[model samples]
Target: MPGGLALDTILPSEIKERLSRGEQLTIIDVREDEEVAAGTIPGAKHIPLGQLPERHTEIPQAEEVILVCRSGNRSGRALGYLESLGYKGLKNMTGGMLEWED
Candidate 1:
């Protein structure tokens, strides 16, 4: 958790529930391509953590964006970076795919 107490988080179950209810969430998978090849959230966009600085614009600024990774670490860092750039409505998916699959 890069922001520690300031980092916002949403559980995998919560995301699934929202999607089930037809909520169109903006989920960004910050994991690398190889890791993503294994699988990912149903509709999450991939933007590997390292590329975020240059690819951040691809993410929506007006919607609630959920950052996800292998665990929760990288996405947390991604959230912090975006926050520094003044991006709002950002959340890190807690436990990432590991918990998502669980």
Candidate 2:
């Protein structure tokens, strides 16, 4: 995290704004099923962090993708994992769902 190699990040508000503006965003929620049951960004695809190894291929590499979790930690990890596999246009949702409002 000390180097410039850190993954890019987007705030929850920014994501909400983009979605509200009719942007076709690809958001992947990496929280567990129970955590996601509480609520999530509408239209986000649910893929738990544990399942990403096998399910990551389902994500698009050519388009921007936002990763989310209860907090930013898991999503950051998810972003790193996907990046290692050559996926581009990835961003970690800073503060995650904890800072997401509706």
Top lDDT model: 1
The 0-to-1 C-alpha lDDT of every candidate, in the order given, reads 0.92, 0.90
Q: Candidate 1, residues 18-86: lDDT per residue as tens digits?
A: 999999989999999999999998889999999999999999886799999989999999999999998
Q: TM-score of predicted model 1?
A: 0.91
Tens digits of per-residue lDDT for model 2 on 1-102? 465434488888888888889988899999999999999898999999999999999999878999999879999999999999999999998888988954
How much does each candidate deviate from the true structure in C-alpha RMSD? 3.0, 2.8
Relative to the true structure, candidate 2 has a C-alpha RMSD (angstroms) of 2.8
| Stretch of 10 with least lDDT, candidate 2 | 1-10
Off by over 4 Å in 1: 1-7
